[model samples]
Target: MAETLLQDPRTKYPVPPFPKQHQDVPGRQSAMQPVPDCGEDSYVGSGKLTGRRAVITGGDSGIGRAVAIAYAREGADVLISYLDEHDDAESTAQIVRDAGRRCVLVSGDIQEQVHCQAIVQRAVDELGGVDILVNNAAFQMSHKDLQDFSAQELERTFRTNVFATFFLTQAAAPHMAPGSSVINTASINADKPNATLVAYAATKGALQNLTGGLAQLLAEKGIRVNCVAPGPVWTPLIPSTMDAEKASKFGEQVPFKRPAQPAELAAAYVMLASEGASYMSGATVAVTGGVPLI
Candidate 1:
């Protein structure tokens, strides 16, 4: 019998010290160094999500983009909500379309309750109905001191990370029938908070709590709610939010000694949205590269 080949996780993707780089807020995936691998050509689908309609925020890049690609390949039509990353969103849309799935693009700030509600409505109006909601959008900034964080910055982080999740869930829940899934993109910071990322960590903690509560609340309705707590992932958010030095050495603290490519995070989202996870809810699936989540 022939033995199957195995790939080592540590050596699967690029490692640090990566080239120091930076981008403004809501970074473009096209501009990242080495760019993130979103499984554009790698993921294979088996119709796990056939006939399902999905709404994914921040679908233009990073983990969201990877999920969009995976979901589309899995036979799900997707609606991507982004904050003015036109080029990135269009690229993702094209990938989905090429996969023979309808990809609707909506660009705006999810921080607003109205906008979050609008995203769900758009999904219902265009994609038929919402069967999966991936609350993958987020905002963060590193500050050496709490005092260094302006009130506006703090508010923006919470509004973008926490408030938007709440708004989108509330709006989408009505449109979602039984067997639907709500997947939130929490972070390892929820369990192991980073001092420099105090506000972002807080929001992630809130997401975990929200996931647990919503899972129980929606159980009777047959809608599962869960979260993915990823460690350092090589996404546009890294260079745009962290300092150059930190960005260069990103994910070094993890046992893997390297950040995860966005593609690495897609499978979790796909499983959670699939029937395989029908009995799983309120669970925080940690993809922390061997970093245990307390």
Candidate 2:
């Protein structure tokens, strides 16, 4: 038998205690000190999602971008929805096109129900139909005190992180046929709440609950709903939302000394979106670097 090569997870990627850095909200992955490895070169697909059409929110960078690349290589045409990150979005689109799949870009605020609906409509009109819907876009800000959170800030966080998922799913459901799948990008914060990220954590908890309820609701239609709960991942969101000191030390708390690269999380999203997950609905697959979610 040919020997299988195994790489140790702890040292597979760069370890933290990284240099201090920062970017504005909805950070650009290109500017990070160690730009996240979103599997631009390494992921090799086996046609798990052949001929499928997918819509990915926040597909410009981070986990979303990684999933888009994987799906494209796996023979799926993708529609990427993001905020005003044209450069990043273009880069992702190019990669998808390089994989010989169609890539459509939609830029707007998902907090608006109309925009969410439009995103789905665009996919149906452009990609032919939507077989996979990935609600991966989110907003987060670090605040030490709950009192520091303002009414507008709280509303924006919930609207972007929680409400948009419902709006997008509701819009896409009618257009999605049986055997379609919906994958929500949840977080470890849902189980082990982060004091400084109370609002974001609360939104993720709601997503997990929403996943279970929606899974049951959609089961009758042969649609599966699931979520991926990730721990510390080295994405632009860390340097942008966290203090420089905190960002430098990100992921040290996990059992794996370093944070996961966006590439590391792509497989989970692909698995949930593929037909193999036919029996896997309402499942919360934790990719938390050894952190138990219970």
**lDDT of each residue in 90-124, candidate 2, tens digit only:** 99999999999999999999999999999999999
**Model 2: residue 74 alpha-carbon error in angstroms:** 0.3
Model 1 superposed RMSD (Cα): 0.8
In the predicted model 2, the residue pairs found to clash are none
**lDDT tens readout by residue for model 1, 1-294:** 889788999989998999999999878899888899999979999999999999999999999999999999999999999999999999999999999999999999998999998899999889899999999999999999879999999999999999999999999999889999999999999999999999999999999999999999999889999999999999999999998899999999889999999999999999999999999999999999999886
* TM-scores for the candidates: 0.99, 0.98
